[model samples]
Target chain A: MATADSTSPCTEYIHIAYPVSPIDRVTWVDLPDALWHEILRFSAVQDLVRMERVCKKFNIQLDRKDRSHGAQEQGREREREREREQEQLSSIHDLWKTHCQHRWNDKPRYKLTDEREDWLRRHYDEHFATVDYGDTAGGATGRATGRATGSRTESSHVMMGNAAPFPVANTASSSPSTTSTPSLSKFSWKKTYFWMEQELARTTLTYDELESLDWYFNFTPLAGGRGKDTLLRCIFRHGLLSIGGAGFPSLPYRMLFLHPGDNPDIFSEQQVNATDQHSDTDTTTDATTDTETHDNPIFHGGIDTSQARRHNQEQAVLIADFPLHYVSRLHDSGEWLMTNAHVTFVSTDEAGALTYKDRNFQ
Target chain B: MADEGNGIIRLRSSDGKVFELTESAAEISELLKDSPREEDDEVTEIDIVRVASPCLEKVVEFMKHYDEEKMKEIPTPLGGSTFNEVMDQPWYQDFVSDEKMNRDMLFNMLSAANFLGIKPLLDLTCLKVTFQITGKNAEEIRELLRLPELTPEEEAKAREEHSWIFEEA
Candidate 1:
C-alpha cells in the first residue's frame, strides 16, 4: 500500500538541492519517539508485537511498554516515568478488556464486581468451580416426585461438598408457627460440584430467554424443601442471575420484561384484576406450561452465581412466577447481580387457596 | 484578525526558504492561527522555522487543496479497520504514495505537521509510515528504512521472544 505520487503542483515547491544530513541513515530515528508511538497507537495487537522485531530502538519501546504494565517492579528513579507509561498501557488494556467483554453498544457497560473478579482470577488459573445440584441428585429426585408435590429434600446424610451450610428458616406450611421447626432438618444437604465448562453460561441458561421457559431457573432452585422464607433466602443468595460483560453473551443482551405477553409480576397477582387469561400463558410455553403449572418442578438452576446488586427498579423481577401468581422484590444486591424471588405454596386440597410470600435480601 | 481582502501569510522554513500561501490556506496551520497579528498588517509572516522547507511547502500545498471550506465535506473515518481503509483511498493514495514522496520526505512532513499542529497532514503522514512498516518483517523493514541489521544472535533472540506474534504470520 506504500506509494508516493505527486498529486499536485505542490511538488514545484519541493527542494531538490537540499543538503543531506548524516542522520538520514535512520530517518525514522530522527523523528521524536512520541510521534512513532502515535503511529504505533493505530497498530493492531499482532502488529504491535511484530514491530518489536523492527530494530533495537523500536524493540526498546515495546520492551518499555511491556515493563510498564508491572510498574511496581521498577526502581525508584524511573517511578514517575513508569507511572506515565503505565497509564498508556492501561488505556490499551481497557480497550482489550472491552473487546474481550464483547461490548456492542454505547449503553453503560456493567462494572466489574469482586465476585466476578474472583471468578475471573480463578478462571485464568483453571480453579473456578461451581456445584450444580440440578444435574445429579436434584435432577433425579425432581423428575421422580412428579408435578403436584414437586418438592423433594436431600438426606441430611448426604455430604455438603464445597457448599458450606448456611442457616435456613424453615417456613413449611405444615408448621405456620413462625418459629423454627424440627422439619427444617429434613432438608438434605445437597452436594455441590465444580462446574465443567459447558454448564457455565451458554446452553445452561439464556438470561434473555425467560419468556420461553415455563419458569426461568437460573442459579436458584425452584423447589425449596424447608420454609418458603428459607427458600427465598436461598433464592436471594443464588437467584441474582448474571448480566452481561463479566462472563458470557458478550453482546447487548437483556430480557425486555416489559412486553405485553410477559406480564411481569412486580406486585402480587392478587393486586391486579384476575382475568381468565391463563390460557394465553399456556399457549406461550405450550405443553411445558401444563407440566410446570401442575408440578412447579425445579429445572436446571445453572450453577455459578456472580456478585449481584439491586439498582434503580424498586420492582425488578427476582423469582418469576407463571401467570402472575407470585412476585419477588430485590431483597439483596451483590456487586455483580440483583435478585428478587417469589415463593408460593400450592394447595393440594380442592380449596384452591394459595399463599404468596415475598422477600427481599439487600 | 487580519483583513480578508487579498491577505497572504509568509512562512520561513527551517532551511531558510520563504514560502507564501493565501491566509485561507495558512489558517490550516494552527501555529499561524495562534500568533498575534494586527488587522492592518499586509502580509502576515510566521516562522515555521522548525520544519524543513520542502516539507513546509508540501504542507502548504495540501492545505491549499483542503482549505477550511473543502475540509468540511470530507468525512472523518471511524477508528480501527475503517481508518486504515480510508487511508488507502485514491485521494489519500495520490497524497501518500511512495513515488510522489519517499520515506525521508514523508518523515520530514510528519515532523513538520507535528510542529505546525496540522492534524490531517500529520495523520496522513503517520498512516503512510505505518502502512509501510506494519506488516513487514524486521529485516524487510530494516531494508526499507535503511537501518543497520541486528546480529544473528539478536535476531534469533527477538524471533524467539516474539514467536507468539509470528505464529499467525
Candidate 2:
C-alpha cells in the first residue's frame, strides 16, 4: 500500500529495477535504406514533398525517383501534348478557313506603301523567296521548301497577283512550318525584336507587317475587317501559326506586342470568356447592330442587297473596334510598358475585400 | 517438402538461444527453406546471427500464422484512418506493443523478417512503425526517434514546400 515516493525501500527498488528510460534504449536511426524506399513507394504522391524534408537522405531518394520519372514519362506526356495541340490547330484552321471565305468574298487587296514594302520584303522574302520565286520559277521555290511544288502553293498565290485579295489554302499551310520545333521556340522573335528595336533604333517592317501591327492598335471586331478579314492578324493573336509550327519564324510581331501571357483560362474557359466578353462589350457599344451580328450572313439568311451594305459597315466597325481599347489603355499610360508574360502577380488591398476573380481581373 | 517426414528445425539466435519449430513452421522463412540438410535424422540449425534472441523469438512466433501458401494474402490496411487500422488487430497490437519490445526491438523484428525473407512479417513490422510515426508532428517524430533537430532554414523550407499539407492540418 506504500508509494515509492513515500517509502525509502520502495524508491530504492524502483531506481534499481528501471535503470534507463524506455525511449532512450531504443534507436530508430538504424532502419535500412531499403525499408525507407519501400515505405515511400507505399506513401501517397502528395506525401512525397513532406517525406523529402525528413532528412537529407530522404530528400536525395525522393529527388532521384522524380528525376527518373521525369525522363521517359515526361517525354511521352509531351508527345501526347503535341498530338493534342496539332488536332486543336487543324480544327481551328477549319474554322478560320470558313470565316475567311464568308467574310472576304468581295474583299479588296491590301495596298502596299513603300515603307511597308521594304518591311515585308526583308521578313517574308527569305522564307518564300517571294520576290525571286514568285517572279521566276514558283515550282522551284515550292520544291525547295518541301511544299506541293507542282503548281499551286504560297509562292504561286503570290505570283498570281503579287497581292492576293484573299489568303488561299496553301498560304495557311505553307507559310508557317509546323513540324519544326515546339511552342516555346516560336517566341524567340520577341528576343530578336527587342535587340532590333533597342540596338537598331528603328523598325523596317513591310507594309503587310505594318498592317498586321495596326491590327493591335484599335478594337476591331473579330469577324469583321473593312473589305479584308485580317486573317494574318487573327492567326498571330490566337496562336494559330504557333500551334503546329515549332521553330517557324512566321510569328507576327503584333502577336508578340499584344499577347496577354499565361492566363491559365486563355486556351479553354478563358477563350470562351474572351469571346463572350467581346460580344458583351460590342453589344453595349452597338445596341442596334446586335441582331445583325452574324457577319457571315450568306452562310445563314438568303442573300439580301440591304444586308450587303450592313455587312460592309460591320467590317469597318470590326476593324475599328479591335485595337481602340488596347491602344487607348497604352496611350492613357503615357509611357512604354514592358511585359514578360511569365511574371504576373495579383495584389489585393490590406482589407482583403476582393474575391479571386476580381483581383485576377484587376 | 513432405510434412509426414518433416521434423523440428533449430534456430540459433544471435545471443546463442536456440528455438525449435516444426519443419513446416521453419518453411515460412525462405532462408531456412533452402538451408542444406545435414541428415534426415538431424535437426536443421539455421544460425540467424543477425537477430537478437528476443526479436528472433517474436519472429518465430509470427511465422506460425505466416502461411507460405497464403503469403501473398496479407491484408492491406483499410484507408481513411491516419494509421493503418490493421495494426490495431488483437494479435498484432499485443505482439508489437509488448512490454519488453521497445522501438529498437520492433526494428530488429523488421530486420529479422527482412533477413529471413518472411515478407508478411516484414510488412507487418514496417507498417507498425509507420503507424507510430504517421500522424505525429515533425517535432514529435524527431523527438521520438531521437533525430537531430533540423536547422531553421531547413524547417522553413520544408514547411514552404509542403504548405498545402500543413494548411490542411
Candidate 3:
C-alpha cells in the first residue's frame, strides 16, 4: 500500500527536487512530530499499539523519550529537558481519561485517592473480574446446552455464578500492579482499553439469541429471594445488561413477576400491556405489587385448565384491545431485544394508556 | 493577490503556483485570515511557502466547498470498517478517496491543512489516516506505513513485553 510506482501521478511531485532540501524527499514520516501526534490521537487503543510496533520512530514518538546522546557540556540542560518530556508523557492521563469517559459514560464514578495511579488500567482490571464471572470451567458447556434446549436451569447456573460475591482476592491476583505504584508512564491505557473492548465484545450476545431465551429465568429465583429492587440494582451494577438508564422498557418488572413454569410468551404479552398500566400508576407502589405478584401461586403454577383459559382470554385481549397508536408504535420500534432494549413510555391520552417511543427506531 | 472589489484572495504555493479563492472560503484557513495585508494595496496576497502546489490546490478545493453543518462528526475509536461507513457524506469520502490522493499526497494534504491552520480539513485528513491504520496488524501496519523492519532482538523483546497484544483474539 505504501510503495508508489513511478508511473503514478504522485511521482511527478515527488521527483521535483526543491532547492531547500536536496537529499530528503518529503514523505509521511517527514510530517512534524506534533502533527503526527494529532493524527494518532484519533486512533483506537488497539490501532495505537499496532502503530507503535510499525517502526522505531513511532515507538520513540509514542514513548516520547529522547535517546540522543548530547555533549557533556549540555548535561544540566538535557536533564531539565528530560524532566519536561517526562511531564508531557505523564499528561497522557488526560487522553486516557477522555477514552474512559467515552467508553464507560454510564458507569458509576468512584473517587481516586492516589492521583498518579492508572485509573483506566485499574478499572479495566476490576471490571474484567466482574464480567468474567461465569466463563471459567463449565461456562462453555452451560451456554451450549442453554442454546440447544433453551434451558432455564443452565442459564440460572450462570446467573447464580453472577450473583456470587465478587472475589476480592481475584482482583489482586489478576492485576500485578495492585502491589506496585502503577506509574502512569509505564502503564499503557491503550492496552487496557483494547482489552476492555475485547471483553465487551466477548460478553455481548446477539440480541435475537438473548431475546429468544428464557432470560427472565436467569434472575427469577434470585429476584424472588433477594427482592426485585436489589436484584435489579445488582444487574445494573454487575454490567450484565448493556442497556442504559431506567427506560429499559419493563424487562426488570417482567423478570420479577415471572416464574419457572409460567409461559414466558403469555406473560411477555400481558406485561407489555401491564407495563403501560404499571408506568402510569405510582412507581412507589411497585415494591408492594412485586410481593403480591410473587406470592400468587397462579404465576408459579404450571399451565392447567384454568391457567389455559386465562392465557387464552389475555391473549385475546392483547390482540383486540391494543390501540391503533400502540400498534403503530410497536411497529416503529424494531424487534424487542431483551438485553439492550430502550423504550420511552409516553402517555398518549387522558385515559393514561401508555405507548413507547424507541430512539433506535427513529 | 485578493481582488478587493471582487473579494478574492490569492495564495501563492511554494512551487510558484497561485490559486484564487473567495474571501469567505479563504477565511476557513486561520493562517490566511490572520495574515497581514498592505492597507494601501488594492489586493491581498499570502505566501504559503511550506505547502506545494498540488496540496494547496486540494486544500483550496476543500475550503471552497467546506460546510460545518453538513460535515458529519467522525466518532472516535472509529467503529466503521470502511471510510465510507464512518463518513456517510459521499462528497467528503470521494474527496479523500480520489485515486490521485496517494500516500504522499494524503500526507502532504495533512501537512498543508495543519500548516494553514484549517482545523476541519486537518481533522478530516487525520480521520482518514486513522481509518487506514485501524484493524491492521503490526506487520500490515509496518508495510502500510513503509516503516523499516526492526532487528530480530528488538522484535523478540517487543513480543515478550507485549505478548498479550500480539496474541490474536
Candidate with maximal lDDT = 3
Q: Rate residue A249 of model 1 by lDDT.
A: 24
What residue pairs are clashing in model 3? none
Q: Show the lowest summed lDDT stretch of 10 residues, model 3 chain B.
A: B160-169
- Kindly report which residue stretches of model 3 are placed more than 4 angstroms away from their true locations once superposed: A1-25, A61-97, A109-188, A191-362, B1-6, B40-42, B67-70, B77-79, B164-169
Q: Give me the displacement of residue B127 in model 2, in angstroms.
A: 1.2
Fill in the DockQ of model 2: 0.06
- Cα distance off (Å), candidate 1, residue A52: 3.1
Tell how far residue B46 is off in model 1, in angstroms: 2.3
Error of 1 at A71 (Å): 12
Individual DockQ of the candidates?
0.17, 0.06, 0.25
Tens digits of per-residue lDDT for model 1, B106-167: 87778777767788787777776767776566556767767667678657666655554344
All candidates' TM-scores?
Answer: 0.44, 0.38, 0.52
Off by over 4 Å in 1: A1-26, A55-362, B4-6, B68-90, B145-161, B167-169
RMSD to the true structure for each prediction, in A, is 18.6, 24.2, 14.9
In angstroms, the error of model 2 at A124 is 34
Which candidate has the highest TM-score of all? 3
